[model samples]
Target: MTALPPVVDEQTWRDALADLLVREKAATKELDAIAAARRRLPAVKLPEYRLTAEDGSSVTLAEVFDGRSQLVIYHHMWSDGNRWQCSGCTGLTSQWTRTGALAELDARFVVVTNGPMDEILAYKKRVGNEMTWYSSAGSAFGADMDAGPGEGFAFNVFLRDGDDVYRTWHTTSRGAEQFSLFFAISDVLPYGRQEVWQDVPDGWPQDPTYERWLTSKDVAALYGDPEA
Candidate 1:
């Protein structure tokens, strides 16, 4: 091959890199605007529903917030019987950080699910996440939000002004993308970036392809002792 051209001067290289950084910042701003527009869309009204808590206490949707106008509900994908926990949910939950900023915005975040109170508590404790979690066992709230079993992952936001409650936003695809913030901030090495098809250094192991972890069990397993 012909000899390569002379290397560019440091100042020239820095100028070109600066220009690219400006463009990247502008692109990020545009993406943020798009996300803001999505959040501004109107929300459907949700009927008031009651759900049980992990403490064996009962709470209404509004009560979960401790008297706040907004709520961010994470439908944790936990199941009973042979289905002890959801890998995808576990993956997302493991990435959550309890930022006091959430409360400053007049909103509270919670993970609601049909899993038993004891099981949910055990998992939360094991994971070491401080985000509030609740059990929606025997409640229609989960079904109403399309977050029950057989339903895909969902992140939903609700706002209440007085007694009126409306769903402000909901997302299901690549919803766990925010988990990358940890790596972007250099807090932790990226783990599942492979899910985005991004290139990795040669010889690195690829991320697992399974959507959720499955427990070893047959169809008859559901009717037997659930905790066994």
Candidate 2:
């Protein structure tokens, strides 16, 4: 039988791991370049539509941008009646950071959904997100963006010049695998709490999935006890 190679010492093992990480970083840079290229492509024009804000205020697509040159609408998966407060949409929102500097870039980001303004407000409050949210409760905007029921996950960007709005780009991928600050940190840290029930080191409890984290009314009650 052939003999196996000798086991490496701790120092050698650490050096090998560091080399692998360097290569991974280089590969990640390539991925970022590709995403940048996609962003640089021309925008596509979407039809005009109206949506409602949480305060019951109605606004058209042009109005939503507040006269900005670009608009990014996250077609949240909230639907009328029974399908309100979609988990996937909630997950995406949870990962978003408020773009306070968006105005400087001539861009506005908003969440569009089929749920009523009240429902959207409730979900936003529950998730503690401060980003602007709106509802397309009575409109086909969601469907037009391919975010309607039974439609695949997607997000689209639009650019406005004069009175014309054009579609810029869109994307949909496995939620958990998407490269965000959360995932980047999780990939390096020994414990990255994502998608509740993710396994952790011994003595650490599995984190609750994002779905349960958002919908569970007793979340505070269950995890609230500081002494526990």
Candidate 3:
């Protein structure tokens, strides 16, 4: 067990907390400035590409906007043959099962993978997600973005102007970690993700991040909910 902080009078504890609060406030302002700069970054015009829908229909880049003007595409990591998408990517996309409000905000979210249409539909049905799914099979869309399906998972943002589409921004690797709220919640716990990669006090349980799936079953176990 970790040792508790030393007992101190109220005034001293308040002083120590105020000192940390100053640094926290400064960090918040810096993050706000960074976000402002990100908004101003220039967008590039994307090359022509077509994606396949679950029904085997072709969906163009402009059509993906779906009259919303803004589109957010998730380049899901996928595998061939009997394999499925990367477990991490599957969990990441499953988090977006409910995105109806995005349409109201004039933003659309879609999933694009290199997997075949049938494979994509099968997995979607298994998980019961409603987000639009598309296949980039035999399309330059994946290669142009440099994250071809199974190679890596990425999030891409696009903007539509008249009949043209522009690549506004993109993020991958650890930069895209913010999309998964599960990581955000785990960050606040005492054990702090319980990952060996994190620096924690001695005796804290540690395991590789790959082992922590944090599935629906895990949630049901915690809350003892029979319906989950």
**Which model scores highest in lDDT?**
3
Model 3, clash count? 0
lDDT of 2: 0.67
lDDT of 1: 0.67
Worst 10 residues of 1 by lDDT: 211-220
Span of ten consecutive residues with least summed lDDT in model 2: 219-228
Candidate 1 Cα misplacement greater than 4 A, ranges: 1-16, 82-84, 183-196, 199-228
Number of the top candidate by TM-score? Answer: 3
Clashes of each: 0, 9, 0
Per-model root-mean-square deviation over C-alphas: 7.4, 6.8, 3.9
Candidates 1 and 3 compared: the better one by lDDT is: 3
lDDT values for all models: 0.67, 0.67, 0.78
TM-score of each: 0.74, 0.72, 0.84
Error of 1 at 200 (Å): 5.9
lDDT tens digits, residue span 7-78, model 1: 799999899879989989998899899899987797898788887776679877778877889888888876
